[model samples]
Target: MNTQQRTSTLQHSGVNEAEVSKLFRNTYSLLAMTLTFSALVAFGSMTFNLPHPGIIIMLVGFYGLLFLTTKLRNSPWGLVSTFAFTGFLGYTLGPILNMYLSLPNGGSLVTMALGMTALVFFSLSAYAILTRKDFSFLSGFIMAGFVVLLCAVVASFFIEISGLQMAISAGFVLFSSAVILYQTSSIIHGGEDNYIMATITLFVSIYNLFLSLLHLLGIFGGDD
Candidate 1:
């Protein structure tokens, strides 16, 4: 939104052009840094062939750190918590990536998945920013989809459902993409005022998007 329009809406939304611009800068910068840190941790973990922590540990660590980060978001410690969360997540992924790498044409699949993720995230995010369209309408759908996705994930452990993993991956690809659009649009339109939270949200979407792509590619491209 332009300055004049922001000024007109200031009483209602308290969002100005300068605030939005600052949020965009801070969020993106922190996101880039956190991503780089996660990559480094992933690379190191993979190099050492770290053991998989299993789903339970992974879930606990992820949610624990996420909650901690959210609580400390206004403090300097928030940055530390963000790295801890992202780094732990990347470490957890190393074992999965190694499993994929052990498959036929695994390297190619990983490369392809990463490429696709970057393409999808950047393109959708750019579209949201340039268009500056309000995407708050997607909130309800995204939230509902997230709950269903979580349930499916939990149920897969007990139920021997065929192709359930692939289905979940596909759902995540769509869900994560919508989240990126919604998050970017929210930032541009000044719905999210906190850059720390914005960074975490977008970071999570990117991370999940990449993992989902990796799973889908591995399912379709890996050798039998």
Candidate 2:
């Protein structure tokens, strides 16, 4: 190519990079906001004694919102959907918070959740930056795992076996960890231009991973 053409190409590439970087920044900012909102919703729901129907509605709404976000990840609509999903997740998390609060060592559960969340986010973020590997290849595997996980969750309603619960929690922790790795790598490698969606995916994984780890720890560790 001529010198002028080369310069134009470089300019275009630079713009794209800047856009991607902006997207990443926006996504993380939104993620932080959503986490805060979710925490507030959970706390409020527990405090107000919200009905089971409200929780169910929130859960269903969260799934719908997530579906919408994933479908429109390339557009502004995706960002809106992501915020909606986060709100719904927060509302749905109320019952879990309520249950944990009822436990003798509820404060410990919160500490564990916070610690696990930090560990997962920092470790996965570091790995993404240092390795700079594209994890989009794992998309299919993660989808399959999610399917199996859904089925297992449904089955648990009937089984109610402690061993099965433990096993499922273990699988969730692993699966969520993989999601964190994949989502983070996608951001670093420029595979994902929508950081809001990316952040939402990573946040969900971190949240689930922390929950699973907390459950496992509670099961194995004695209440002090």
Clashes of each: 0, 0
Which numbered prediction scores highest in lDDT against the true structure? 1
Which stretch of 10 consecutive residues in model 2 shows the poorest summed lDDT?
A: 50-59
- Cα lDDT for residue 31, model 1? 95
List all candidate RMSDs to the true structure: 3.4, 2.9
Reference-based lDDT, each prediction = 0.90, 0.79
Looking at model 1, residue 170 earns an lDDT score of 96
- Per-residue lDDT over 6-38 for candidate 2, one digit per residue giving the tens place of the 0 to 100 score: 999999889877886787788778888888888
Q: Give the runs in model 2 whose Cα sits over 4 Å from its true position.
A: 1-13, 51-59, 70-80, 222-224
Best by TM-score: 1
Could you estimate the TM-score for every candidate?
A: 0.92, 0.84
**Candidate 2 TM-score to native:** 0.84
